[model samples]
Target: MNTFEKAAHFALTAHEGQIRKANPIPFILHPMEVAQIVSTMTHSQEVMAAAVLHDVVEDTSVTLEEVRETFGDRVAWLVEKETENKRHNLPAADTWQIRKEESLLDLKNCDDKDVQILWMADKLSNLRSFFRSRLRDGDRMWELFNQKDPEKQKWYYSKILELCDQLQDTTAYREYKILLKAIFSTDAINLQYQTGAFHFEV
Candidate 1:
């Protein structure tokens, strides 16, 4: 099988019985789409594999060691770095702070162009996703930050804009920005459960 196919199998088996807390979409699809999106930016097998197993540690019982044993050490390391700790029950602000720190650290260490491309692609995806979800219910999305929750909104967009500046490739950054802006005009490309996601005037 090709890279994408291999990645699909790896992610599917890893997330075999998991579901997204945000909704139900056979959790494997999330990583697969991330991997695919990253692939469009770089042909690096490492980044693609990282995208495939991105949530394995956080979403399933799978361990980093297990991923290394099955895929490879490099792939496992990237996956580990990108994994989110949603399992924690920290106060809202604390959790968001930790997550933000983790991502910023990892991105700072991303000297490799391929890695930066993947990271930027991931952030771009998140920004576009939230924008649509916001348009669907602006009040709820806006109110989410009333308690000063960093992850509530906008912070992600701001950080992503920063990451985009960190990107060494101008062309890639511009294209990604165009897509990020286009999200306001186009339908929520990746969202499934959220309807009226494009309520924001184009």
Candidate 2:
């Protein structure tokens, strides 16, 4: 099998029995959706493989070494760029902001467009899920996440929109922006992005 196929199999095995938080959907579906989104942007196999494997190290017992050994350096590097240093000992809620801050800083500084593609793919999948849940559950949907406040969620997602502004031409980027506004309200999102007022501590 090719890199994307291998990574899909690896991810499926690693995420076995795991379901999305507060939803019954299988966890592998998230990575699958991300890979599909990444495909809409680029045909690079490494990037697509990385998208499928993005959460393995962060969410499973899989290691970077294992990924590198199996998939080679480039795919592993893409996966590493997508991974977060989740301070596993501490409460996830307590460490959420710091983790996101670090991720955003890295994305801001990274020159590679592939990294941005990976991030956009993953986040777009997340925002799509959020939009669907919001439609079905309304305000109560916020309670399902670690960062329950919609304002805090807005801050993180808006920063993503700002950081990925260079990708405005892509359909994925446009859809992501539309979903962000749909969930957060266009006026509020516009004000937050325009004024740089989304930096408050959660």
Candidate 3:
């Protein structure tokens, strides 16, 4: 098998029996969708492999060293950029903002465009899931996340849209922008009186 195939197999095995937090869908499907989104932006097998493997080191017992040994340096590096420090010792809600801030800082500081592709792909998959769940459950869908505040969620995703503006020409980025508007347009309107502008219009 090639790099992407190997990473997909590893991700499937690592995420065995895990399910999405907001729905009963198998967790592996999320990474598969992310990898698919990544494919729309780049032909690099290493980036695609990293997309499939991104959550393993962060969510499972798998180590970065293991990914490096199996997939080599470039794949592992891209995965590392996608990985977050979950700060498992504390309540997830308490740590949520800081973790997201750190992630944004990393994305802002990194010069590599492939890392942006990986991040946007993962986020687009998340937004797709959020959009589906919102259609079914409405605002109640926010209750499933560690950070239940929709404002904070909007801030994080909106920041991603700003950071990934370099990818504006890609189909993945365009879809991401549309989803962001669909999900947050109401919030933008609600805040219009105070902020004097619609923040999410694309």
By TM-score, the best candidate is: 3
lDDT, residue 153, model 2: 92
**Candidate 2 on 1-202: residue-level lDDT in tens?**
8878988999999999999974679999999999999999999999999999999999999999999999999999999999999999999999999999999999999879899899999999999898667656667788888899889999999998889866779999988887887778745444444563432221
Query: How do the predictions measure up, each by TM-score?
Result: 0.71, 0.90, 0.92
lDDT of 3 by residue, 100-196 (tens): 9999999999979999999999999999998777766768888999999988999999999899867989998899888888776666434543455
Off by over 4 Å in 2: 186-202
lDDT winner: 3
lDDT of candidate 1 over 62-147, digit per residue (tens): 88888888778777777776776663666655576667667777766666565566666666555555555555554354344423
Stretches of candidate 1 exceeding 4 Å from the true structure: 2-4, 21-24, 85-93, 142-152, 164-172, 175-202
Query: How far out, in Å, is residue 49 in model 2?
Result: 0.2
lDDT of 3: 0.90
Q: lDDT scores for all predictions?
A: 0.62, 0.88, 0.90
Quote the lDDT for 96 in model 3: 96
Select the stronger candidate by TM-score from 2 and 3. Answer: 3
